[model samples]
Target: MNYRSSELLEKAKYYCNELSKHHILSKYWYELALVLKGSTARGNSDQYSDIDLVFFCDKNILDRIVKDYYDEGLISREDGIFLPLPEWIGHYNLESYDDLIGYFKEKNYPQIWEYTNIIILHDELNRFSGIVEEYNNYVFQDMITDIKEKYLSLQLTLDWLRHPLKRGDELSVILHCSKIIRLICQLSYLIDEKTYPHDKWLFYYLKQTEFGNRNENKIKELGKNIINNSIPLQVDKELDEYSQYVLAESIITDLKNQIQLKYGNEPWLDEWYSFV
Candidate 1:
């Protein structure tokens, strides 16, 4: 842990310790497990970032605490301390190990990634620690299949949009550009073996990674221009008379080539262009 992480962890520890003293939480205090998650645990947090914590305890106890404490706003901003209160507080049941296993089996990689990336603050019986271990050990072959399907679907959509774009449909052209941005971001995460962060952190994560950092500005500018229903002048100049869209098709095609070169060709790629 770096200085920031250590600082965040200390704050979380203090908050959890105070929270454990609540009448509703006191009974399960010793048994409860605490974990630091999100950007803080991932070591990517900054001054503007907020800490996220998860507490694992009995389902019944958690339910009661949710009703009597969290729902009641007992843990609120009224208390001023070194750290802002947890941005998110998640409660998992220690007894319901099956749910965690089910998330992994169902290829819910985001949730699994959340658990695996956590920093354990407390785990009296090692229940939460064991779940983290399980997440780390789980195979993700199914996740790769899901990503490939998404890539293929987006590729097909881009192909279909070409006709409308050639007919001077601005909406179709914009949609095409937007989907290209999405596909590139998705492919970057797939190649990195990382879960795609939620939209709030999507661009941040993209620019922070090695592969994405190179095209980060291009992706952002192109995506913004597309959303605004316009194409970049440079991109428009690159579009050949035979091409359907005002924006350069080579942008997306080049990204596809990079994915193929880096990860090797997928069988779906051949099928993807077959319909085009």
Candidate 2:
């Protein structure tokens, strides 16, 4: 049950070798590709961690391989479809390397991390590695810009929702508090120059970083309280008769100031204040 990265890589290799035993797969062995993703690739894997792999091949070939395994009882139908390949990919056609890159780029940060952190088991032309290199070298200015915009927009929404929250609208209170927690987590990752994973993995990813480690327990508690429709003690103490939304706003502002102090001002900061 303990899933080490080396063991996971070996398992992937074994699967590739098994697939290669088939005449059709053997003929296209070089074209068959495997990538180790998720917690294992990040080196934060645990006993319960799921092994996520990305298999790149023609759709028909993938289908045949999966079906063969299923028919032979080597893998359960669910295991053949879901464990090796997630159910989400069923909706998309990802046969080409270009298509894979496009999917990775367009998907959320976790998926991008998966693409960037892959260990290609077999790539004849070395296409997969080249694509990963391109992504790694690409400028992140646009991504930063997008995050800044989202932060500002959420701030504005929180500002607008403050009145309803104070008016004792339960839904507004929950939504407002939730947005603050999310904004802070996103800003923390952005300031650290790390890609923020999806929301479910946000705190887990945060715990793995130095920045998050300092406030890991605090953030975890705050996140739980937010989900349970309660305000964290720290936020309540800082409220000072102001609504919870204001506390959230001030936290984000303080974070912005800290980032500015550490990294100095950029055009984005100027633009952010211009809107404020």
Candidate 3:
């Protein structure tokens, strides 16, 4: 962690002590409070950042804590406000693992792992670790595959849009590119669910996840180039028309190789390419 991050965590510690002074939710002083998102941010100073703290506790204690904080007007949309997890989601039952799982499943949420895999604060025994582990094992594979399939389909669509006859088709291709970028960020969060910088998390997480691969440098270049140069095109410009096709082609090709290594190829690999 950087110096700014360390200082932010220290500030969070001070916040916890302040809460303990209230006595209304003092029982949670002993609760686990693991900090996250030290490296997955863009800002250089603590003045621009909010320290993320995930506190795991009993349901009753959590309820009392939320009530006390809200009563104190600590939770708000403005900066430096302390938001209880339930208020952030606009739902209140997160203390129950079953309820949280069911809610995410029902919403078809992509960041289930994020909400479930909170960093514990004070519990030395690491009781909440198993919650994250269970979802990673059971939910991760399907989410990865779903994202892969969506990218593949978008690739085929973009490839088709490359034909001269499909002038207006480029608009749809751009929409699909937006979806692909959003999905990539969401999947990367599941792959690296430690924290949230909101904007910078996806880029940092993707880079970290791809760091050990031989193709990491190439993948980084492609992603950065697409975002920097290709994303701001006008609807009818030639740059906008061709950029999606090429960008989608590059992303699909790189992801195919990665997926093949991670998930292996099937007998119908060539046929699947044609189908895509």
Q: Which candidate has the top score in lDDT?
A: 1
Q: What TM-score goes with each of the models?
A: 0.71, 0.70, 0.59
Ranking by lDDT: 1, 2, 3
Of candidate 2, the 10-residue stretch with the lowest lDDT total is: 85-94
Model 1 C-alpha lDDT per residue in residues 62-142, reported as the tens digit of each score: 555555654566544322212235454322222234556676777665677567777887788987777656665554565
Name the weakest run of 10 consecutive residues (lDDT summed) in model 1.
75-84
**CA displacement after TM-score superposition, residue 120 of candidate 3 (Å):** 3.3
Which prediction has more favorable TM-score, 2 or 3?
A: 2
Report residue 206 deviation for candidate 2 (angstroms).
1.4
What would the per-residue lDDT of candidate 2 be over residues 171-244, giving only the tens digit for each residue? 66667677767767766776676667777787667765554665666555544544334642232232345445
Q: For residue 272, give model 1's deviation from the true position in Å.
A: 0.9
Runs of candidate 3 with Cα error greater than 4 angstroms are 27-47, 58-119, 124-126, 133-136, 139-148, 151-153, 156-174, 182-199, 211-241, 267-276
Question: What value does the lDDT take at residue 180 in candidate 1?
Answer: 72
How much lDDT does each candidate structure score?
Answer: 0.63, 0.59, 0.47
Model 3's alpha-carbon lDDT is 0.47
167-253: candidate 3 lDDT, tens digit per residue: 444445545555555544444434332222244445544554542133445545544544333434344546445554566556555
Quote the lDDT for 46 in model 2: 62
